[model samples]
Target: MIAALGLAELKLLLRNRTAATLAVLMPLAAGLYFALGVGGEDDSWTMVVTLQLLFSFGFTVYVTVTTALTARRQDLYLKRLRTGAASDVVVLTGILLPVVVLGLAQALVLLGVSMAAGAPLPTRPDLLVLALIGGAAISCAAGVCTSGLTGTAELAQITTAPFFFAMIIGGLMGMSGGEDAWVFLIPGGGLGTLTGAAWGGPTDHVLEALASVVAWTAVATALSTRFFRWDPRT
Candidate 1:
C-alpha cells in the first residue's frame, strides 16, 4: 500500500511542472553552476559543496515537501487518505518517500559533479554522510511543520521563506566558522559544520554540529506532531 501511494505521488509530482522543476531542475542547475564554475582549492571546494548541499536540501527536499503536502491538503487528497486504514505515519511517509529519494539522488549527483570538476575526495567521508542524512532529515521535518501553516500550495512559497532563509544563513555561518556557539541553533549550521569537517576544514565543533542537527530535527518533528493539519483550511 505504501509503495502504491509512493508510486502515485511520484506520477503526480512529475505531472506538475512547477513542482517537478523545483524538485529536479532548480537544484541541479544551482549545484552544477558551482561545481562547474567554482575553483577547487580545499576552502573553495568546501564552500562550493556546502552551497550545493544547501541548495539541494532547501529547494529540492524542503520546499517540495511543503508544497506537496499543501497541495494534497487543498485538494482533499490528504483528508481522503486519512479516511483509509493506513496510519498517519504510513500515509505521510508514502507521500514523502519519492521526494526524499529524489533529494538524495540529486545530492549524490551534485557531489559527483563536484568531484568531476576537480574537487578532491572528502577527507572524512563518514562525516559527510552524516551531514547529508542529518540535513535531509532537518529539511523533511521542517517541511512537515511548515505545511501546517501554509493555507494553500501557493502560500507555501511565502510561508516557507523564513526557515528557508534561516537554513541558508546557518549554512553560511557554518562554512565561514561560527564566531559563537549560538549559530549551531540555526537550521543548517550542523550541515555546514559536517560538510566542512568532511572536507578537512575543521573538527573542533563536530559535537556541537551533531547536537544542533539532531536538536533541530527533534524540534521540527515535535512541531509537526502537535500542529500538522490533515484537513484543508476553509
Candidate 2:
C-alpha cells in the first residue's frame, strides 16, 4: 500500500511539467552544456563526481524541495496522504524514495557517460558511492526541512534560494582546484570531499566533511519532525 502511494507520487511528479522537466531533464541538460562548454577536458575523477553531484543537488535539492512544498500547498497532497493508512514517516519516506532512486540512477548514468567518454572510472568507487548516497540523503532531508518554511508551491523557488546558492558556491570552489575551510560546512561541500577522495588522494579532511553532513542531517530531521505540517499553513 505504501509502495503504491510512493509510486503514485512519482507518477504525479512525472506528469507535472515544471517538476518533471527540472527534476529529470534539467541535470542532463546541464551536463550537456558543461560537456560542450568545457570541450570535454581530460577532467579528473573528481570532476566526474562533481558533475554528478551538480545534478543530484540542483535537481533533487533545489527543484524538488520547492516542488514538494508547492505540491503540499496547492494540491493538498501532504494533507491527503496523512488521512490515509500511511503514517507520517511512511508518507515522507515513500515520497522521498522516488527522488532517491532517481538520484542514484542519474548519478550512475552520468558516471557511465563520463567513463565512456574516456574519463577514468572513479579510483575509489566506494567514495563515489558515499558522495552519491550522502549527497542525495542530505538534499532530500534539506528539502523537507525547507518545506516547513514554504507558504506556497509557486513560491517554492524563492524560499529555496539560500540552499541553492550555498550548493553552487561550494561547487565553484571545487572547480577552482582549491577548497575553503568554511565550505566544509556547506551541504554540497561534503560531496566535494567525497569526490576529492575518489579522484585524488585522501584530504585527511574526510571526517570533517562526513561530520558536517551528519550534523546537517540531524538538524534537518529534528526540524522536520517538529514543524512539518500535513495541512497548508493558511
Candidate 3:
C-alpha cells in the first residue's frame, strides 16, 4: 500500500511543472553552478559541499514536501488516504518518500560534482551517510510542521523561507572554522559539521554534531505530530 501511494505521489510530482522544476531542476542547477562556476583559492570543499547538501534539503525536500502536503490536503487527497486501510504513518511516509529520495539523489549528484571539480573524497563515508539521513529527516519533519500552517501550496514559498534561510546561515556558521557553540543550535549547523568532518575538515566534535542533528530531528518530529493536519485549513 505504501509503495502504491509512493508511486502515485511520484507521478503527481512529475506532472506538476512548477513543483517538478523546484524539486528536480532548481537544486541541480544551483548546485552545479556552485560546484563548477564558483572558485576561490580559499574555498573549502567541505563548505561548498555542505552548502550543496543544504540547498538540496532546503528546496528539494523541505519546500517540496510542504507544498505537496498542503496541496494534497486542499485537494482532499490526504483525507481520503486516511480513510483507507493504510495507517497514518504509512500514508505520510508514502507521500514523503519520493521527495526524500529525490533530495538524497540530488545530494549525491552534487557531491559527485564537487568531487569531479577536485574536491577530495570523503574519508568517512559512514558519517557522510549519517549527515545525509539526518538532514533529510529533519527537513522532512519540518516540512510537515510547516504544512499545517500553509493555507495553500502557493503560500509554502513564504512559510518555508525562515527555516530555509536558517539552513543556509547555519551551514555558513558551521564552516566558519570557529568554536561558536551556538552555531550547532541552528538547523543545518550540525549537519554541516558532520559533512565537513566526513571530508576531513574536523573530527574533534563529531559527537556534538550528531547530537545536534538528533535533537533537531526530535523537536521537528514532535512538532509535526502535534500540528500536521490531514484536512485543508478552512
Find the candidate with the highest lDDT and give its number.
1
Cα-lDDT of candidate 1: 0.90
Best by TM-score: 1
| Runs off by more than 4 Å, candidate 1 | 177-179
- Write one digit per residue (lDDT tens) for candidate 2, span 67-107: 76667656787778788887888877788788778877876
lDDT score, candidate 1, position 19:
92
* C-alpha lDDT values of all predictions: 0.90, 0.70, 0.89
Off by over 4 Å in 3: 39-42, 176-178
Clash-forming residue pairs, model 3: none
Better of 2 and 3 by lDDT: 3
Comparing 1 with 2 on TM-score, the higher-scoring candidate is 1
Could you tell me the lDDT of residue 150 within candidate 2? 84
- TM-score-based ranking: 1, 3, 2
